[model samples]
Target: MKKFLAAAVFSCFSLSLFANSFSEEMLNIYAKLSVRFVLMSTLKDELSESVNICIGSKAEDERAATTLIDLMHEHYPAGIGEYKIYVIKSDYSNINFCKEASLFFVLSIEDIDLPKVITFAQENKILTMSYDQVLVEDGIDISLFIGREIRPYISLANIFAKDIYLDNVLLRVSKIYKKQEE
Candidate 1:
């Protein structure tokens, strides 16, 4: 009861932030859904006792990253499930700061800096989620496919490369992302 109420309130607050733009609205929706999908991962048990989520960004996206962390703290005061949530703000240059993270939510970053982050995440077996769906094709573990009904967009090859596994239920409903061959 209380849980449902809290989620409803949070959803309203989240959606309100990007109500002016359809694409921004989809991003907000995807951000919220990302939280739920974390629990559905088969590797959830391997996460730290206090799950560390790194909001990876460049200098330009610092404000957006901070806003996201603040919102997360406000809405998830009790953390999610039995795992305590710890949001860390990280810059692209200092990707090492996120080595302890279980999940890395990459904000809009330069193309050159992206591969470094992706490599780090893959090597650490940390789940990589992106704010932009286009990044999914670039080796991000997850994003949302904004269509008539939004759905999760996942890169199976990338996740597999990272030795990360999601539950079948999530995979069933997601749109598998395939990298384009040159």
Candidate 2:
């Protein structure tokens, strides 16, 4: 009985550690994606001097949003004076507010009308990014996928539709998908 109880406790502890590690890995990926998006956007459009990132998510994903926000601020401090981060709640009215943002990060789709949001983003020429691979298939511009390692999955149709251009280096590394033929 004592051995069984000890093993159960150890199993729970191991699971907890694995979850934390995975969360940290995700956070790192998000931060890297944010920086790459900002840099690439700046390079694509010389006229744009600053990058504005809107982090959109449902209420339940507030912790994830906060983690990304903190990581971004740490990497690109306010002293840099070239980028801004905004937290946007899942609200229809907030759509207008996020239109001005250069890039939109969809942290969570639950409780949010993703299709509606994507439509608004497309109409406004905002680059949509997410960690969800399914969103990429559903027309989101950029998605991070982790298989053997973290990799970026991009939709060429969505990218061109938004008039967003990525450099050849990024294009080479990313797995690009196109719309299906009729």
Candidate 3:
């Protein structure tokens, strides 16, 4: 019984460490993406006073949104009036707001109509990002993942399809994906 108890405690400690590492990675990704948006906007001559980020998530995923918001605030303190993060329910009515956003991070596409969201983003020049590779494959602009290392998978097709212009420096660092020639 003592041995079992000790093993359980060790397992819990290991799990917590893994969770902390994941959280830290997520925070770093968000910070990098925020900076990328600012730089992209500047390159496009659309530099604004504040970068608007619209987070789309279902009601059940509110906790994830809250965590991301907290990280964003921590990384970008109030004194820096450079970015604003807004959490919005994934709904048709909020499409306009999403279109106006500088960047849209979809927390979960399960409850949302992803094609519609993508179409709106493409039409409005809003960059879309997700942690899901499936979404990236479906033409989302960027996907943040950790496979031995943290990196971004960028879709060149999606980027060029949009009206916005991304700097070549950003392009060179990312893993660019282009559609196969049929």
Candidate 4:
């Protein structure tokens, strides 16, 4: 009951933030679904720590991240009180820790100044996601890149297979690549 109440409040708060970020159309679409372009759609009625994007620029990742959280809140209004969405700007260092985050989205892959964020993601058990191909080659779990239809596709072959809980919302992946092998 306490957790439910918490989810109710946080969900509302997050929705308010969403209303400020995305367009009304997007808000409406998100309202009807969990809208996971990755693996977030699988889990239900339970809390999951979302992807923590390491952004090099607030201009790029912040809006998207906020919009996603807000959508989550709106979709699960009464049962999603809190979301673990922690963001950190990239320092372009050689390496970093991402294992703690449920999913790690690298917005500034170039700013990180590393040959492989994928190696790091794999080393620590963090499921990596990126919008770039070179980064995907490094072993990111999902690629949330805007392609053919403007919506991103999920790269199942790239994701690290592990014993982690993923939301069902993510499984309904947008089909960006028509014939890509799974």
Name the candidate that leads on lDDT.
1
TM-score of 2: 0.76
Could you give candidate 2's per-residue lDDT for residues 1-182 as a string of tens digits? 66556534433442233222225556666776765665665333642555667877765566666777777777666613454444343444476788667678887665347888789889988888885677888878888764544568888788787777888788788777666772
Query: Which stretches of candidate 3 lie above 4 Å from their native place?
Result: 1-24, 41-44, 79-93, 180-182
For model 3, which pairs clash? none
Best TM-score among the predictions, by candidate number: 1
Candidate 1 stretches with Cα past 4 Å from truth are 1-24, 180-182
Per-residue CA lDDT of candidate 3, range 1-182, in tens? 66555534433442233222124445446655754554564323564565567776655555566567666767666624454444343444476876657777776666347887788888777888875655887778877644444456778678777756677777666676666672
lDDT of every model, 2 decimals: 0.74, 0.67, 0.62, 0.44
Ranking by lDDT: 1, 2, 3, 4
**Residue 85 of model 4, lDDT score:** 41
- What's the lDDT for candidate 2? 0.67
Q: Please estimate how well model 3 matches the true structure, expressed as its whole-model Cα lDDT.
A: 0.62
Q: List per-candidate RMSD values in Å.
A: 6.3, 7.3, 7.3, 10.9
TM-score of each: 0.81, 0.76, 0.73, 0.48
Better of 1 and 2 by TM-score: 1
lDDT of 4 by residue, 1-182 (tens): 66556534443443344313333333334323322422353222233644344432134445554554555556655433354444444534523644444455554445344346655655655555553434554555555433233233454554425434454445555533322344
